[model samples]
Target: MDSSLVMIGLTNVLSFNNIACILGGTLLGLFVGAMPGLSATMALALLLPLTFSFDPATGLSMLASLYVGASYGGSIAAILLRTPGTPSAAATVLDGFPLSQQGRAGEALGVSLFASFFGGLMSGIALLTAAPLLGTLVLEFGPVELFAIAVLGITIIGSLAQGSVISGLLSGGLGLLLSTVGMDLTTGTPRMTFDQINLFGGIDFTVALIGLFSVPQALTLIENSHQGGKVASRITDRLMPRWSTIKQLMPNILRSSGIGIVVGLIPGTGGDTASWFAYNEAKRFAKDKSRFGKGEVAGVAAPEAANNAVVGGALIPTIALGIPGSSSTAILLGALMVQGILPGPNLLTDYGDVTYTLIWAVILANIALLVVGLAFTKMSVSVTKIPDGFIACAILTLCIIGAFAINNSLFDVGLMLGFGLFGYWMSKAGVSPAPMVIGLILGPVMETSFQQSMLIGNDSFGVFLESPIATVLLILALLSILQATPFFRWLRVPFKRRLKPD
Candidate 1:
């Protein structure tokens, strides 16, 4: 709040170089985001090396710009090509692709861009206002509260798991196990390192992120090439929806933003979960709910707003605590550390300039994304014309570089390739990588917090209910599980029938 710090932040962000960096990052994000298989996490991984040369504030501001831009950029391809540029855009494609088929692609894309901008702007303002308050709350958190938060996050993974809840839990449990690979935190005993010197430092989250997201995409591209696959993008003439259309969708936009913020505040929940929840809620409330799957404008707007708003909302927990809100932010934590900046309660008190700069960066990036997205609509369509082989090779190159750059480990490269195969198989089996990503990112916090809380409770099972927050969270977790069960749905049917006096 000091005048000097505010002045410094404005100066740093307003400088020619930083402005150029933001624009460059946004453009790169938009392009990478429009291409299926090239995710925001991978794009950030590729850009990580470039940040080593800049000042911490400048570098992080640029990265944040790219992060926001790319999340919104994914919707372009989801609408135009019927393929999600990133997994979070999957909900966008439900109505977006159909809009394209109906020759309203331009209007759909335009609405998406505007809704994304508004949602991001709203969330950015929310971050600016909410971060400090949340940071204060973070000061009150200990192992008990932290553990409660982690469990809450894990519960939201249900929204993204897609397949059997059991499988999702298994994948998440495996990730938690993998997170314990390094030496024990309190005790110095090495746990899962196998005495390998490289593993003594633990698996680099960035390397795992790149490997998990990018390599599998590369392999998919190659496999498709051999099968004579084709991809195409088309831009129709209509560029804007009617005023009536906008009026009809306003309610959905607001509702989706609310869902995005709430879900994003939970550590493991991400843009995909926000979008999915928003889409479902929209269907639930719509007058003609059956039209949801038939290219309704509200369908397109709901997820677009939700996903974009998630960029700002996700930052809340990451900045207030050390936990990441999504996979992309998990890599961002490493980036923050690389710049000698740690993400925690002190971020606002100690580094308000950087924090606010990042908030402004989100807003600025959203504006840039809209302009760039609109101007290049036709050119982006040309992406579909690229040879599948070349795209495959290019992605492979990025994956290799991305893996190696994380701690400069050759072992990570092999790890990336191994995970690549595993991811491909998982995709075929209808399993979601998102739950695993969240599990991997939040595993250490969950395990360590659980253990510490238990020790403090003297092995008493009732100890978990000592804190009101803990008690409430555990109850909510049970409710979430029950709500997702078939028996609960069946039970609700009778209640609804009685209420309606049938």
Candidate 2:
């Protein structure tokens, strides 16, 4: 990295116009993310078109700020209303709402905000340093390796199912099937379009995301409208935690942040996965595990830090390899393409200044999140006070608008509604939508890479197993599958017993 180039990028990020854009974007993100049925990805998708009018640096910075802010903002609703504003904050609801009910809403919010800030700061540092190194490493990867990695990601996610692993696999298989609905990329022949032109382009991801995540929540809200008062009372304490409490939770925050960064670096995984993994790890390692899910401050800190940290980590692959680590970063990649910037190895070499500026923007966004988030904590509590019916109607309206806005097509709107109904049913069946989402995103990559690898190897199946990286990834995938089985759990019990000291 050139020192002069780095300084130039920092200078650009610190400019008044760029700072204003970041601030504005962060504020918008906080509002959107604090509302149930809205997600960071949907927010970015809706906002991407507006960035076309701005300079590249300003536009990208704004998106980065929004990503950072939304990652943290989800906790507000999760804490106050027992509903996560974003899927990434789902784990936060386990402890956050408990704390709110205990009349410690301020304490939970403060810890969440601070942990989010710290995690994002650490991830920004990781993005600044680790991305370049990882970029070089990925240079050694072939299509076979990439395909293997995608398979590994899907396997890991499916195996981590909170309910039946079969259900998770079934959901993932369904997504993979849906991913094949469009025309074949290689043959240019329709597979499952059924004569619909819109189907030729495949289902729009944003439409599916909105329908799957937002619609179900809206329906839930509407169904529960008659039974609810405000989930919690007004919050009226300081919005910052005491220094002593911060010091005590620092270790858990740091550990969870590390977990989040690793998860975020893997393409197809997102903050939701990171938060759940962090929450589980925190519970496993805590001295007082009994406190978890009953308003343990550490419980709130773990997921908040992990989810926020995902913002910077997810950006790493998006910037360096053109592989989006999560849905929000996928939208950021779209924003880059709209600005005529192509991501991959050439991104750093041809657009070093812009790349570095985006990295710096991540750091700046976290700082702004800390400042702006604390300022709004008191006011945001009022969100829970809104009537459930009113909230449901507002969200349904936004969902309609957002779905239609993607391509200005009523067909997309219909698709969203159909998927929304499907999603609601899936939820009712106790199946998670996360594995399906991962399968949907990675299915194309895996298919394309596998075909390309076969072509490169003259139709030889051994090509996939030949690469050392691919081999290792496949082994890990196998292990992940085995780990999800009851037999593996039984086997592990004895090993754990043997390892324990008498």
Winner by lDDT: 2
What are the TM-scores, per candidate, against the unseen true structure? Answer: 0.82, 0.81
All candidates' lDDT scores? Answer: 0.76, 0.82
Tens-digit lDDT track for model 2 on 1-502?
5567578779999999999999988888887778765678767755665676789999999999998988888999999888898889999999999888888889999999999999999999999887766666665777888788777767766766547777877877787788888989799899889999999988776677677767887798898888857655557667789999999999999999999999998755688899999999999999989999898999999999999998888888766665567657766766776677744445666787888899999999999998898888677766646776887787778878877877889999999899889989998998867667666666777788889999988999899778988898799889878877899989999999999999
TM-score of 2: 0.81
Residue runs of model 2 more than 4 Å from their true location after superposition: 1-18, 32-63, 77-108, 240-256, 259-303, 313-358, 500-502
Q: How many residue pairs clash in each candidate?
A: 0, 0
Error (Å) of candidate 2 at residue 206 is 2.2
In terms of lDDT, model 2 sits at 0.82
